[model samples]
Target: MAKRLSLLLLRVSLGGLLLVWGVNKVVNIDHSMAIAENFYFGLLAAETWLPVAGVVQMAVGLLIIAGFARRWVYPIQLLLNGVSLAAVIASVIDPWGWFLEGTNALFYPSLIIFAGSLVVMAFADQDQLALDARKAPAPVSWKARRDCGQ
Candidate 1:
């Protein structure tokens, strides 16, 4: 029960973070473009693609929150968050700007989010609260497999 609840909380929080960022990209495209320019080496800055990307991200976020299709959605979320973490690694390493010039304490949370996504991916099979859990086959004990002869 505790594990399920913990996974549910992590999933909802990470999904909510993605959803909010997606909405920001769609509603405040200029801001999104500026972030891309500043952190992502100007990638994802095309005005035409911003809203479309936002919609796609929103879908992925919703699927994550619902714990549906985790096999695919978890990887997508992990990759996206991984990229985000990479973009802000400097900030995470030097949030106070002790040595890094452009570091900001605000971006440090990306590290935590990335770690949470990793946790979700690693323990996905144990997430009984996931919508697809019912569809997954029960795990076979090692003893049972041994008894079955290879």
Candidate 2:
């Protein structure tokens, strides 16, 4: 019971963050574009990538929070978090002094949260409160009737 609750909480927290971040990216396209220009797209100026990332984040957030299609969603979410964590970690550890001051401190908490959420999802029931939570078909053996000592 407690475990389920904790997993649910983790899902909500991470999902909410992703949803907000995605929407923010969409709503504030200028800011997103600037970030992309400076941070993401210096090498590859594929205009579609930013919007695609927003859509993916929003979809992942909704799927994870609603607990729908978790078999695929959970792994995708894990990968997304890992990538974000890696980027932040890399920026923090850059010896070239390109990283902003105190950014590492800010990212440390997010990294911890991401790792914790990954652990929770890894062991979560995945079906709780999800659309996928349906009764599975009974076994064929259960359909057979037996005669008792007739």
Candidate 1, clashing residue pairs? none
Candidate 2 lDDT over 13-122, as tens digits, reads 77777887678666776667775666554422345666667778899888878877877877877777776676567544653446554354555555775686677566
Instruction: Say which candidate scores most in lDDT.
Output: 1
Q: For each candidate in the order shown, give its overall lDDT on alpha carbons.
A: 0.92, 0.67
lDDT of 2: 0.67
Clash pairs, candidate 2, are none
* lDDT (Cα, tens digit) per residue for candidate 1, span 20-103: 989988999999999999999998898988888899899999999999999999999999999999999999999999999989
Which residue runs of candidate 2 sit more than 4 Å off their true CA positions? 41-48, 90-102, 134-150
